[model samples]
Target: MKTFTKLAFLGIFAATGIIIAGATAAQDAPAKLGDLEVTGAFTKAMLPGQPVGGGYFTIKNNGKSDDMLVSVSSPVAGTVEMHEMAMQGEVMKMRKLDTGIAIPAGKTVELTPGGLHLMFLKVKEPFKQGGKVPVTLSFEKAGKVDITLPVEAAGPGGHEHK
Candidate 1:
């Protein structure tokens, strides 16, 4: 009776270990860009024939040195440029910046609307809401990281986190 009980307990423990391992594997199944951490990601609604779309996200520098975000690429758009918005004279101007935005060491840089954002111009098709867009964000030091941008409804915010 003692031998049978020990064998049953070991079997149960082994099964639990396998279950936990499976869960962890599923969480990391997506394609990764680099070691940079991405948070608070969101994007505006997409409309047919719209000239551009904007994406906002927060990046955190976990390393000791600072890094620059050089560019972005997306399959849904023909061109993805790092852009900044400002008021030039009486007009609100959006300018494409060839150089990427810099993030300080141990600091979080937010790319929000009306600020530094990724401009998705000349979209190939309408980005359907509640869909997924694969975006590759390239950085100077972190190299490139691929992330899935989840499309949301026409709203004021996307996915936000503290």
Candidate 2:
């Protein structure tokens, strides 16, 4: 009788362990960023009929020496370009650069509004609130890094959480 009880208890414990593990595996997994360390990411709220959208993220250089971001691509937009808003003559103009942005060694470069950003133009679908867009950023030395930017409603600023 004791042997029978022990066998049944072992079977029950094994089944329960498997059930717990299966439930845990169903949750969303952590996002993977290749080569570079990504932090302090946010995207401005997009509106319908808006010609362009912007994506912002902080890229940290972990390796020795500096690196340059060559390009960025995404399926959400027709084209992704590196742009800078600067004063040329008397008016501020947004100019697209042929080369990519640069990041210094042991320092973080930020891509934010009115600064270095990914210009997502000709969006296929209307960017709705609470949606996520996947973008792949390629660097000269760091290779390629994948990031997802969350779309939010129109607000004063990005909602950041530590």
Candidate 3:
């Protein structure tokens, strides 16, 4: 009878610990802002002597009206700009989109390599892999959203290590 009581006590203690841990993890999960959802945000690890870095993410708009991503800013970079890459004839060109990228109503927009992305110019320090960088994104309708960009390997198609 004593052994049975002790076993029951241990089971209750283990169940309580799991419940607490699950609750804490749920609190850390990402949250949506009304009709906007931002996910899979990350930046590439900086290369040696490279002053520029790229940030990529996915933005989903669930509202009835369209939204535009106007600007992006980061303390680690001197300046951040929204840019688009395209091929014109035989030449490859990249240009800044001052007007911002549009996120259509009920559609998702992706900022990835070789396409629409955020350019971090004049970085204060090289971004290291397995690190997190904070950035603020300004949307025409969504207002300003703060997110952490996880740093991954030094490649055009790199996944967040964290």
Candidate 4:
């Protein structure tokens, strides 16, 4: 009787763990906002003493009306600005989008590296791998939605950290 009870308890514990893991995965899935699907939201890990960080994500508009991403803010940085990088006359120039990025109806907008991205200025602490950065995205029509961006491992930039 004791052996049977112990086995039953272990099985229940394992099933509970699996259920909790499934729930956590669902929570990390794409976040939605008024017919908009926000996916692949992540930021690269930053080295210690690094003053800035970059964030990338993809937004899909499923509605018939267009929307605008007005602003992005995070507690990790003093200000987060939307920026664009383009090649102009053999020089890669970067500019801030004061008006914000537009999400056309029935279209997808990707904020990727070397193109459109979020610039985290005045960062209080460097982003570490396996950590999450909480941010609030404000849209003109969809209102505001809070999302968390997972920090991934940074690629080699010719620098080594102890």
Comparing 1 and 2 on TM-score, the stronger one? 2
Ten-residue stretch with the least lDDT total in model 1: 18-27
Any runs in candidate 4 off by more than 4 Å, and if so which? 1-27, 156-162
Give per-residue CA lDDT, model 3, range 53-161, as digits (tens). Answer: 7787778999999999888899999999998765455444568898999999999887866567788889999888787778888889879888888776554232322
Runs of candidate 3 with Cα error greater than 4 angstroms are: 1-31, 156-162
> What shift in Å separates residue 132 of candidate 4 from its native position after superposition?
0.4
- TM-score order, best first, reads 4, 3, 2, 1
lDDT of 3 at 162: 24
Show the lowest summed lDDT stretch of 10 residues, model 2: 18-27
Higher-TM-score candidate of 3 and 4: 4
Candidate 1's TM-score reads 0.70
lDDT for every model? 0.63, 0.61, 0.69, 0.73
The ten-residue window of minimal lDDT in model 3 covers: 18-27
Q: Identify the leading candidate in terms of lDDT.
A: 4
Instruction: Give TM-scores for every candidate, taking all chains together and pairing residue i with residue i.
Output: 0.70, 0.71, 0.76, 0.78
Off by over 4 Å in 1: 1-35, 87-91, 157-162
Rank all candidate structures by their lDDT, best first, as comma-separated numbers: 4, 3, 1, 2
Return the lDDT, model 2, position 98.
77
- Each candidate structure's count of clashing pairs: 4, 0, 0, 0
Rate residue 125 of model 2 by lDDT: 79
RMSD of each: 19.7, 21.2, 18.5, 17.7
Candidate 1 C-alpha lDDT tens digits along 14-75: 43221101110111243433546886565655655556666767787877788899889998
